[model samples]
Target chain A: METVMLDTGISERGDMQKSRVKVGIKKLDLFYSDFQALKDVNMDIEEKKVTALIGPSGCGKSTFLRCINRMNDLIPGCKVTGDILIDGTDIYKENIDVAYLRKEVGMVFQKPNPFELSVFDNIAYGPRTHGLRDKKKLEIIVERSLRHAALWDEVKDRLNKTAMGLSGGQQQRLCIARVLAVEPSIVLMDEPTSALDPISTGKIEDLIAALKNDYTIIIVTHNMQQAARVSDYTAFFLLGDMIEMGPTTRVFQLPGDKRTEDYITGRFG
Target chain B: MTANDRWSSKEMILQYRARQKRRQAIAYAFMYLAAAFAVATMLAIIGFIFTKGISEISWEFLTSDVHDAGREGGILPIIINTLYLVGLGLLFAAPLSVLAAIYMTEYSKQGILIKIIRYFTSNLAGIPSIIFGLFGFMFFAKILGWSWSLLSGSATIAIVILPTLIRTSEEAILTVPAGYKEGSLALGATKWQTMVKVVIPTASPGIINGIILGMGRIVGETAALVFTLGSGTDIASSLMSSARSLSLHLFILANEGISTSKAYATATVLIVIVLILNLIAGWFGKRINRYKDAR
Candidate 1:
């Protein structure tokens, strides 16, 4: 069944000849103090597609994900020397507004972290931050984002209840709904399902599959099956280098690099 | 041979277990006795104050103003003056310390400057109240030309409690999970907006706890209020007018030997006020927690 889908994806890539790139990262080198984390990385992420970054622990996949939105600036003694562009605009430019860039590119963390607030407030927080003051407008945005994330029905009646009261899966879905509230063009997930149960993980994977139609998604995952299941394109990382990146079927079934083959074959990590 | 060896080993294990249980029992008894001693000491002090002061706490003694060096009348004016000091001190200290804490935890870089500021805060907490009184008298009453007045006293108390409030609030802000801050920032909220909306709201209960603790210190203060507020035993009509706090009034009465019972009564009132403040603080903390839960 997945092979059939992969054949369709190949024809789809050919049919959609434009293949517009949403994010262009070039010579992206990141250093935490004197220790380099990402070394001369480059990639062109297609618009409205799911790109999975799979690697072992401390392989710098998460670091690369954060660089896309300049979230790395929050860390002390961390520096970046490279160019990252979103839709042909240089994000690392001095004049770029980081807050605005983040609005354009949203992130979901490994742990489900909702503010100590009501579910409604958790969704409305981004819209409210951007100056949506009308109560009716906020309410509409909250409902719309929840519905888009497929969480509206479970929490529709208890919008005013605290978000922390929700189950772990529900909380993670709420976090996704929160990101959707801002209506960003791209979404970043840093192993968002690592902390969830298998059932919850499947739900989020389905949600990611649905989200890729309108939003470009870059996800970091340790689960190889998940990368093969959800992502249209997969990039394998080994010690801060992109070993191989291609269609998910090719990366899993016919890996190009020895390290990628070894890692995928359960030989060694 | 194996069966005989197993029997001897089992017997030794049982003996060891019995000795361990005896030691555990002894430890529990000693811990209970220590706790009892501490609680008993506090109860005894409260008992002594209640016995010595209960007779002097009549309606007349509560309602009327002090007369003849607090020997014949109520300490109403002194009580009112202390309230003014506490109100003003909190008005200044709460905002300043909370903002300072926010800056330290949220905005400031972790470097030598932060280390120095923290060192100074701990040192400030250690300074004796009498030294604070001297500083307030020289700087606020003399140099600033405010004289011995409510303004001077309130300002002194505010500074005296600022370090403690800041330290408590900093810890509170730090306790907020890093994930929440990162989550807010990822939603495109600016640093200030994140602090105000998410960080401050979560830390508020702890911040309020800190403020109330600072209030307790200010209310019980005697030496500082005596030097800066002038022990006037009169209601302060204006910010600059001389006044006396309950603690200072009690101190003056006891020192003069004019009315030891009146002094005890004033002490009792101070204790009651502190007790009420603590109850209110606890209730407020629970309400804040419930509000944060939102369920």
Candidate 2:
């Protein structure tokens, strides 16, 4: 029973201190012009758990996750139908403020999307936009966010420097802290460590586990081992359909669907 | 392995080698001849202008007023008039062109009409300056009832340079990265805020280059001003009154047959002003290019 809360002693890490809202998609379908990207995806992302969306390339996992935060709205031809609710409130409501919705549902893109700003400015940007204008308050938020992402010790002294001056892994973590500064309930990471070296990738993986305590974490990754290492639950997608969804231990060891089994075993994406 | 195969075909190979050498010599000779002709033509023109013009140029010539009667005569009044036109012309043209360019690059949707309009603006660069002068005379001087005054001439010159300024500024604004705008807007800043804060500042170098180049054309222009600015070298108080520009003075003194010496003096002064304008433009162009290319 202790193993339920501990993934090799990971619960000692305080992985769920604040993130407790119900998160998921219900019968979600998406299309780009005439081409359908996702079809009827119904899954529940457990509160305060790191859920991994695993699939081959073009499997629509990224599309489904983007729909949650409405990042897909930026694309002119993309259309989303069905419900993506955070805390049981349909976010796509007519009067829902897209700007305010973005603040609640923070995102980290595939690439490190740190602005062409200094390291401090990058983290300070989100809080400033939310109207945290006091210089001392901005300083404190930047410190905490960077520390949460485990980057403050190395970057604190040189926070005045450009974000682009950082290494690739560092930049990705900087982006994560940037999103975290606004204090959102849910964090969507789309292949966040896909571009990092092994050591940097390990650091980000640990940070993701550490972050689940304060925020709901949903990561879209192609690495099967990554899905097993960091997540409590895993959803397997193939060619735009949710093939299987279950506890991480159960999904990889005993997949309910043939496609999930094949994907986990590297028989197909 | 055989000697004949090792050595290859001697007669045919020799003939081909000879032909290749002849072709190379012909190409090199043609390139040098063309270069020589270009340098010679340029030097010849400059030499002819300076031979008659430079001797007539003096400080007194630039400081005095024009006279067909018992009055002081100097090229200074005309010199001042030329500078006035270029300054006033650019003041009107630069902002108007920048706004027009921003509309084309930022607001317009790139339909058939937009494409046609872009094409027409570029084609204006190919139009003769004389035609621009005619429009200036007919529109500003005649229709606007301003007479052959500084206002009409300068306004006409401004119209002549508008297309150039717009095209250059359009190119500058269009080259701004989509990432800059997106990054700013995603932070809750409005679209206009992003443009004013990040986009326009970054593209400023290109816009400045356009304005400088457009002003150069205004400084050197003569055909357009002759019909619009009048043939007298008298300084005026207001844009509503007739005044003589340097280009117009040069033409009149050179053609009047009574004072061709003063004409040469005025022509030399005009060239110096043009050179100054061109140098400033070149310097500005270099700075803008550096800003755009910075990492």
Candidate 3:
């Protein structure tokens, strides 16, 4: 199988060598029973940068995002082939602990899914699951994570209250905080702002911009403008195929493929 | 044509509305009558039992041991035996049922074997209690040689309620939102950790409801206990010692024509215990809903 290297001149710019490949996918194929959801996809995600996967519904962009953390393993009769390497280590290989991999690759779902626990416990859940027991240590971690997700001030006083009582946006940020408590190196967001209002979405986009300085972030979005605003590199997928991927500016301003240009310029999805 | 001509006149619309209201009134009356009849029957039973037995209940009557085969003294020994039997039965059945339900719902694949297991579990619940009694007598009492003791009776009651417990528990577990499990799993929690931390806590109210229902069955159970548990009026000293449950005492008193009042009193006590369990289940259910609705 041919490995499609979509590398561009952007990687050759000054200080580019410092930005290493955080994830490398080669000839990846995914199927749910008979239906292929992702086909021969390949990309190298950079460290400490935001990579946005933008496509219309049923375009396999979300499928590709889930593939990064192997979340597709939960689905019945799902199959995967080829490799998904994080930091040059093949995550698909046998003996790789999925729990540990997920600890390194935390995910925030589209809908706000806070557990039926207090705000503090919700953020502390990941650390506790990983065997953090000291109360003071958990308190510190929870506060730091909530601060990182930009939800600290709103929920600081109500940390002992049930997380379900928080507003939709607060709940989403709390989920992000929960993931951050695990201290993952990579953060996967599956349309994190799709369910939020404009203001909440703006807050999340700002947080993403701030987050990329520390963690490798991969986000899937349907909004084209959002892709342009937050992502450093943009990958457009259609019908299980990655049609084009490059620097976000180049992909939006001067797309190489006609399909990419058509999709980005408001042609039929 | 004008819009006024196309629509019904005000008088005509009023007439149609009146006719619809009359029809709805008739339907509502019938539905209300059906509900009233169900409540009336339940109240009638409780009224009769309390009226007949309330005068018989007193400190002396409740505290004294059974004398002259349940005709002359309080049912203290029988009450103790009832508690012991039901408690022991629940201890044996509840954890096992919950574990089985979790395995069936969370771990097992939806396949032919699981389908068969579910089929048998549901069918087992519908089986007559008398059949269970016969099985208990044969298996626990005779074959196992734990004959006619509280141990045998409690074990029999456990089997009798196991199917009900497992079915309700499985249904409760199924009602947990899929997102909770997914969220937990995405956080690097293992499947078992997700189940323990997220799934079980969310489903606990439903599980408690199932257990309470099982407790009612065990408390009211008489036919099954009769064959496995001997009708001894004395308080049981050990697992091997023969004992009599409240339902069994009620059965013997009424059946043998020894004391109808005593039987009514025993029935009253059993009803009160079941009522308490039901109230607890309701409280837990409401608390869970309130927590959910807080959002």
lDDT of 3 at A79: 95
Question: What is the two-chain DockQ of model 2?
Answer: 0.22
For candidate 2, the chain B TM-score comes to 0.85
Query: Model 3: which docking level applies?
Result: medium
lDDT per residue as tens, model 1, B1-295: 6675665677789999999999999999999999999999988998899889988998888878999988899988988888899999999899999999998887888889999999999999999989999999999999999999999999999999999999999987987888999999999999999999999998888888888888889999887777898877778989999988988888889898989999999989988898888887787678666754642
Q: Candidate 3 clash total?
A: 0
| Candidate closer to the true structure by DockQ (higher is better), 1 or 2 | 1
Q: DockQ of all candidates, in order? A: 0.68, 0.22, 0.72
By DockQ thresholds, what CAPRI class is model 1? medium
In Å, candidate 3's interface RMSD is: 1.1
Q: What overall lDDT, based on C-alpha atoms, would model 3 receive against the true structure? A: 0.90
Candidate 1 structure quality by residue, lDDT tens digits, A1-269: 12212431643246347678899989989999998999889898989989999989999999999999889999998999988989999999999999999999999999999998999999999999998999999999999999999999999999999888999899999999999999999999999999999999999999999999899999999988888889988898888888778878778777889888888877776
